[model samples]
Target: MEAEYDVAVVGAGPAGATAALVLARSGFRVALIESTRYERSRPGETLPPPARMLLARLGVWDAFSTLGSLPSHGNRSIWGGPEIAESSFIFHPYGEGWHVDRQRFDAMLASTAADAGAEVLYGMSVVDCSAPDADRWHIGLRGESGEAGTMAARAIVDATGRTARIARRLGATRQLADHLVGAAVHYAGPLREDGFTLVEAASSGWWYSAPVPPDRLVVMFMSDADIHRSLRLTEGDRWEHLLAEAPHTMERVEGCRPIAQPAFFAAVSHRLRRNGARGCWLACGDAAIGVDPLSSSGIVRAIRTGEGAGQAIGNWLLGRTDVAGAYERILDAEFEEYMAERSGYYALETRWPHSTFWNRRRTIDAAMRQQP
Candidate 1:
């Protein structure tokens, strides 16, 4: 007979793994489902000081601490002005920020959850999911090798990132923002001892670069999809031309050659109409709220929501009726605060007031005032 877990968390990314970790540690039977095994390279390598505290509380910081991630002092940015300004993490209680190997770092989180007693199904894709009864769900699974099976769970946690695939299947909708894309390129150069991320603004878009593990740099250009296409930023000289506009980034890449051609994809931000339902099932992390990467708080947001949801689900299943309502209220407040902060950050770059991206962003705060 297939074992019916107390909670089945889909997508073993930071959120799902953290949820599974928290639930398992609390003595709940959890099945951590993941489609990919975290083998490919991923962006968003910078971890700010506040995130470190969350990781420590989640009990996964030790695994990350041993990885020898680059110690990031702070950030130097050219946003809102021509002059560069440097902010220091030295002020934060956490002291230093660490740039890490995203792929390896994420895998370690999954491993930690497994070690904590969650049954992690690596490389297993959830093909289908359905509520078998009022209190349980029937989950269809398929392995990478093509084998298939079924499992059951008392509750489900959708940590599948932006798409909220599982939650959508269960009757949720999404609210999308303007088309946004981020083009990335990895560069290598002489070893630098100081660790500080760099950010610069341009009329068409904004640029951000940070150091990751193993002495390497990751540079990304974020802009609207229409602007990127219209400006032809992908072409050979044009791509380099934009980088040159950002002095700090351009200087560091003096002798460095591109590891590969620039790659761009949808960085669209969205949020679910309802984060989770009244039942024990819940949607947390990006699956619940997808934010713009400019915030550099995705990892922390994922961990926070995942851990919060795990406890909420545990209590709700154990017969607490008010936990579900409280959970929604908490997420609602957080989302409102996030939108306010997001608007303030985007407004900092008014250098291109007439630009489509900037104009839309400036008015975004008004548009976001209404909740769906």
Candidate 2:
């Protein structure tokens, strides 16, 4: 007999875990699948204040706060004119935030889902999925031991971050535009005792330095990879060069040594088409609509979507599919609001020196006009 669950969540990251926790706590049987066997630390450590509120709602606030996560005040990305120019300063308010240990933070959230009574299967790979009918989905997953199995669920939630695994399986084309790419490394540092600092380097791109723990800090840079072309450098060399160009950034890292190799990924500005279409599935987090990390809204948005999806899916499992419809409506509205805000921020980047990097992002507003 095929395994059956009231709800099947693919990807046990923040969104999926939160969704699973919500459903399980409410007495619904849930199955959550995670692709990786081990959790690893990553950048995007700072969470906006709004996200902290969501985390509190999920009951993980105390655990997170006690983990030595640094408190975040706000974010400073290049807004208007040149970096040195007074007109260039535009501080976006993030309110109360935290720079967390992502690996631990994510694992803790997923474990909460288990503690709440959801069956979480880590190291399981989702191979395929299908909507057999309007009311159910059939999912195939490969276990860590290489055994393949199938699961049936009333609904599926995709929280696969940027991979959009299920979206691609459905042949959904992703809209990718060159905006910025991110490279980061964690190190010991002359940590900013106050909060995070994001500096716009004249040529190398933007750099972010912040405290994560008393002894360790995370530093990252974002720029158009097509222009920087530093993507080709070996990890160690790349990090050294990044440090060399941003002297102000270096001052913060004065006595620190790298804790890990530098890492980079294309930070393209893109969103999936038909976030919810044929299947009883809803995409959350970077899986649905991705905004610039410059906005520092990624983690907050993920938690919010998780909360929204949980409420929506709970209603659907109880035979109120109309609640799912309402969820999609709210998601669409939120996406529009976020895009508008992000576009305004991107536009501000153009008012500065017109380099290929800023110019490329400048067209985002015009491009979003054709997003239909």
Candidate 3:
């Protein structure tokens, strides 16, 4: 007989773990599956105020806050025209944010799910999933030992980030925008300890810098994928050389060493037409909708979406159909907000370059926009 669970969350990142934690604590049998075992993951160590509020409500903020992470006062932008004025979020009353330790943060989220009675399984990749019935799901997973296993669940949630494995297999077509590509690297020490967002204007694209830990920062240049591809293919070391041009980033990391290899990805804004629910499956996080990386709202959106999915699944399990409709509405609202915010930001940048990366982003259509 195949093992069964009330909820099976795929991809133990922020979204999956949050859903598992919420459901498990509410007395639902939950299985949190992850492909990569967490060991110092890099991306998304910063949490804005909205996300911090969610963490607090979930009862895990204390654990994350005490982990030597710095609070982010606000974000900074250096786009527009000739002169740049730096503004801090402290101008607002609440004044909240965080620069996190991703390794510890992700592990804690997963551990909390397990502590709340969820079965946390690392190194388990979901290879396939299907609807067993109108309200039941069956999923196939490949274990680290090269073994295949199956599990039956009332609902399946996909939090697979950009990969969108389940969405693709389910025949969900996506609309991808090719305006931005990202390349990032982490550095150690002598950098700004207080968290801040730094932006710089460049001919090819724009550069972003953020403090990750006490003395380390993550710096990435985002623009057209062709720009990065050409740099890596033709100029080779040109990417690293360009980092030296960012005023704020270069000053802090004058003599720092990289903790990990520079990673690059073609950033795009896309979303599935339907986030499942034909039977007993749903998708969350990047699997459902993805926006431009420049917004830094992906992690927050993931947690929020997962929470809604968990709630909907809980209601459906109790034979409540109305709850699922509400969940779909929430998804639409959230995605639209994300798209608008990113579109506005890109619009601000477009005034600088006539037909460069900024122009493409500024002229984006309504479909390209998503809410947070």
Best by TM-score: 1
- Report the number of clashing residue pairs per model: 0, 1, 11
lDDT of 2 by residue, 218-252 (tens): 77778887655735544447567656766666777
Q: Encode model 3's per-residue lDDT on 1-372: one tens digit a residue.
A: 998999889988888898888788789999999987886455766677777678888898887777787788777766765455566767655567777777777888888889899998899999988884756778999998989999988887878877778767776656565646678878886664556777776667888778876567887888787767766722556756877656766665777777766687656777666534376556777777777766778788888887877777777778887876777677767767776777776666545565566666655654354322
lDDT of candidate 1 over 1-372, digit per residue (tens)? 987899999998888889999999999999999988887787788888888789888877778888878888998889998999999998888888878898888789889999999999989988888875678889999999999989999999999887799888888877766567889888877745368888888877888888878888888999988788876865768888888778877887778777887888667677677635444678898888887888778888888999988899889779996886788688777877878887888887878878887888866667767645
Q: How does candidate 1 score on lDDT?
A: 0.83
Ten residues in sequence with the least summed lDDT for candidate 1: 271-280
Q: Give per-residue lDDT, candidate 2, residue 111.
A: 86
**TM, every model:** 0.94, 0.87, 0.90
Question: Which wins on lDDT, candidate 2 or candidate 3?
Answer: 3
lDDT per prediction?
0.83, 0.73, 0.75
Candidate 1's C-alpha runs over 4 A off are: 191-193, 231-234, 275-278
Q: In candidate 2, which residue pairs clash?
A: 188-256
Deviation (Å) of 12 in candidate 3: 1.0
Global Cα RMSD, each model = 1.9, 3.5, 2.8
Model 3 lDDT on a 0 to 1 scale: 0.75
